[model samples]
Target chain A: MNPFSYARASDVADAIRQIAADPAARFVAGGTNLIDLMKYDVEHPARLIDISQLPLKSIEETPEGGLLIGAMVPNSDLAYHPLIEQRYPLLASAILAGASQQLRNMASTGGNLLQRTRCFYFYDVVTPCNKRKPGSGCSAISGVNRINAILGTSDACIATHPSDMCVALAALDARVHVAGPGGARTVAFPDFHRLPGATPERDTNLESDEIITGIEIPAKGFNANYSYLKIRDRLSYAFALVSVAAALELEGDTIKEARLALGGVAHKPWRDPAAEAAMRGQHAGESAFTKAADLLLQGAQGYGHNNFKIGLARRAIVRTLSQAARGMPQSQSVKKIR
Target chain B: MAQPGTAEPLRQTDVLPEKIQITLTVNGTRTGLAVAPWTTLLDALRDRLDLTGTKKGCDHGQCGACTVLVDGRRINSCLTLAVMKDGAEVTTVEGLASNGTLHPLQQAFIDHDAFQCGYCTSGQICSAAGLIAEGKARTADEIRELMSGNICRCGAYPNIVAAIQQAMERS
Candidate 1:
């Protein structure tokens, strides 16, 4: 890692002011992702603003019938919080399914959301990747395209967002609160991450000097019947090959409302509004889920190694919806769709 | 405080420089030192403090070869800076044995033949100790998940799991 100046901020204001003063400054919270990038020489910040001592480590109930999670809250705490487990079981499960105990203990909520892609090409300095080095050719396209993105991808980049928690957050319609030089602002979870359009170098909509203060998620009535399914090559400590986060609200065997998001398939958590729209008013069955998944993956383009992900993602959606629907009350059970 | 030729001008250099005083209590002893701004806790413990029991496998937080405890909470020491942990109590593998007696987990590992080359043994032991403290070894699935970060290229996972389970039962 390159030499860098470090300063432990006294408070949130001090952290923000210090970062705003230096363009090359970065806030180090958990250091789970940032330190990895630094070791690989991918992220070379001149100044590291340590904000681990900030008083933003709580999980409180907001006035608007939602949960406000502080940015500094560790992933382990969030995964095991009683409120999160009771109200947002999908989020808890998603957090548990990611990384490992040691990593989850060290990774904060804000750090998890801001984590970069785990693209092999991006991490390997010998390879050329536009996301790692601007204007550099993408080596994953012609080399190993197995773990690359199949949706929301561009010719310049095909890296998938490697986060399971963000997939659940996208499905739950959470909101991110950030503080920067311009002041505090809220960005919806879906819009917080940007696709690699012409510039794959930029990951999120966060400004260079922005600090994520907290994440807010409005209470969902259907959270009681939610599920997060992540399929990976190994049973533990591995990124997902195809994952789905789904919540269902059923009205006497028919779908009243549904929210679905796919991970390991797109540049960001792929929220399929069309799939959600198709599930409404329809019976909660495998056929309905299959059709909706097909619609969601209509324009999916995959390479030779990852073509199986489309089918895996479709099946994952069906299985998740089925499981979530089964967990609902008896009155919600209707005719099972084949 | 009015001196002209003071202290050789502090030797100016291009490297971004900042020194922070860190006082760590390790294995029942208090030690103080000035570490560079970017020095990780693992480096401080291993290189500066001469605690070579903690290994550095994948320096990028992927491997658990540098797992340590700060105030009873387990963390990837390689991902944390030593200066950021001033006055914190750290427990490494070197501190596991007490009064010349091996810890239960360490004894179980040796009895079960949990490791082959023993490169990742110290980390596995430290991480397993923390895992037991956190109640992560309740079930086989939970044990596998909790110990996932510590890789054993010798494919000693089955024995490692057995050793951990035996130690947990004894504790």
Candidate 2:
């Protein structure tokens, strides 16, 4: 890891000021991802501003009957929080489905959103990766792309975002609170992460000077009917190959509203409001679920190694929607298909 | 690729930033150490404080061999910088036992033969200690799921879960 100076921020303002002052400075909270990147020589921060001590670790109920989760809250704490588990169980299930207990304990809510892709070539540094070094060429495009993105992928990059929590957040329409040089602003979950248009280096819309303060989930949490299904090589401690976050608000056996998001399939948590709308007012059954799945997988392009992901993602969507419709959210502790 | 712990141009800085002074209450011993900002807590424990009980299996967060309690919460010490934990209380495997009496989890691991090679035992015990404190994992499946972070390449998972269950009962 490259040597860097350490500065502990006294407050959020101090953190914003420090990061805004230095373009290369990074805010280190829950040093799970950034430290790993630094160790891999992927990131080189001139200074590490310790923002873990900042006053942002609370999970409070919003006036709008939603939950406002501080960025500093550990992934474990957030997943186990009473309000989160009761109201936003989709988010809870998604969080629990990711990484492991130890990693979730160290990973923060804010840092999880900004985590880099787990692309092999990107981390190898020796290999040619457009995300790692733009214009060097994307090795995953022709190389081993078993885990590359299928939707919204540019020719320059095909890396998928590896966050399960963000997938749920995208489905739930969570708003991200950020403090930057431009002052404080809220970014909607879909707008937070960016597609690898031509610049694969930039993963998020969040500027280098900005510090994410908290994430706010609205009142409609889809708590009654939600399921997070992550299919991976291993049952646990593995990244998802095709993960779906399905949530529905049903009127009897009819779907009143629906939200669907996919992880490990695109640069960001893949969501289609149109596909979700396709399920609205439809009976909560295979027919409606298949319609949504077909619409969601529309125009999904897959590389050689990951060609099966398109079909796999389609099946996963239907299965996840079925699970959500029955209020039988997939258990994170249990690996049972039901 | 540069593996962990092979000192290759690990200077303080390109501009030579000074070492950061931090205080850590490790297993009740309050110690002061001036370390580089990039020095991981695992390295600080083994190389500086000589707390070799906490093993460094992957040096990355992939493996939980460097698991330790930072302010009573279990985390990957390898991924955590010592400087980031400025005034924190860290408990390693060496700290788990007191008055020469092994912790319940430590004792249970031995009784259940939870380990073949003992490389990952310390981390498993420390992680189990944290798991018990959390009071979440009740069933064997829950223990297996929660303890998935600590990988035992020796295939001692059945016994490891059993040992954790025993320790949870004692706690």
Candidate 3:
């Protein structure tokens, strides 16, 4: 990692001021992803504004009957929090599904959203990764891409957003709260992450100067019938190969409403409101799920090594929806599909 | 306790550069040290403080060989910058024992023979300590899932889980 100057931010305004002043500076919150990138020579910042001490570690109930999670809330704490575990169990399951116990303890909420879209090449600076260097050409497009994106792909990049929590957030319709020099703004969760359309370097719509303050989700958490199913090479401590976040508001056997999102197969958490609309009023069964899966996987093309992901994603979407519909949310502990 | 020359300039130059001065309460003692911005907590414990018990397997957060308790929460020390945890209490494997008696988990590890190389033992123990404290795991399956971060190449998982179960029961 490059040597850098460190200054602890006194408050949110101070952090914004410090970052806005220097183009080469970056905020260090959990430092889980940023530090690893620095060590790999993928990211080098001249000045690191430490925001770990900032007062943003609270998880509170919003007046709108939703939840407002502070950006600095550790993944482990967020996963085990009473409100999250009880109300937003989908989010809890997603958090526990990704990484290990030690990482979840160190990683923060906002930093998880900003984690880079990566294949194996992104971690090695020696490889030609377009996401790391724009217009430099994407190696995963032609090389090994077992973990590359299948849904949203550009010639410039085909890497997937390796975040299970974001998939759940996308399904829940969460909002990202950020504070910049201009003012505070809430970005819709889907709009927060950008597709790798010729610009894979920019992962999210968040500006360099804007600091994420909190993540807000409205009242409907889909607590009764929601599931976060992560398919990976290992049972745990690995990135998802094809993960599904399925939430349904079911009236008896008929679906009242539905929210479906896919991770590890797209530049961002892949979601289509139209496909979810197709599930409404239909019986929650394999036929309804297969049609929704087909709509979600529309135009999903895959590289040579990752062509299997197309079919895997389809089956995973169906299985995950089946699990949610049966009210048997996938367990993070017992990872084997039942 | 404040050591005599520990406070000396890290660069020893007439003109001072940017090594930030901070205090870390490791185990039970509060030691003052000046560290660079990029200095990780694992390096600080092993190099500066001579607390080599916290091993550094993967400098990245992928390996749990550098697990330690910061402010009573278990986190990967290798990923944490020393400056980021300025005033925090860091409990390494060296601090697991008290007054010549090993921590119950440490004792259970020996009884179960949960390691072969023992390089990942410190991290596993520290992680297990945090896991038991979290009170979220009650069964062997839950222990296996929660302790998945600490990899044992020796494949001593069965014994490790057994050791953790005994420790949990004792606690």
The clash count for each model shown is 0, 0, 0
DockQ of each: 0.31, 0.51, 0.34
Query: Model 2: per-residue lDDT, tens digit, A177-251?
Result: 998877899999989999999999899999888889999999998989999999999989999999999999999
Give me the iRMSD of candidate 2, please: 5.1
Predicted chain A of candidate 2: TM-score:
0.99
As a TM-score, model 3 comes out at 0.96
User: Which regions of candidate 1 deviate over 4 angstroms?
Assistant: A221-223, A328-338, B1-16
Lowest-sum lDDT 10-residue window in model 3 chain A: A126-135
lDDT (Cα, tens digit) per residue for candidate 3, span B1-171: 112212212222244338989999999899999998889999999999999999999898887999999998899998999999989998999998999999999999999999999999999999999999999999888999999999899999999999999999999
TM-score of each: 0.93, 0.97, 0.96
Per-residue accuracy of model 3 over A1-338 as CA lDDT, tens digit each: 77778898999999999999998889989998999988877787777899988899999998999999999999999999999988999999999999998899889999999998658877766667767766567878888899989987888889899999999999999999999999999999989999889888899999999999999989998999999999999998999999999999999999999999999999899999989999999999999999999999999998899999999999999999999999999989986786
Off by over 4 Å in 2: B1-14
Best of the two (1, 2) by DockQ: 2
The runs of at least 3 residues in candidate 3 whose Cα sits more than 4 Å from the true structure, single-residue gaps closed, are: B1-17
Tell how far residue A133 is off in model 1, in angstroms.
1.8
Clashing pairs in 2: none
All candidates in order of lDDT, best leading: 2, 3, 1
RMSD of 1: 6.8
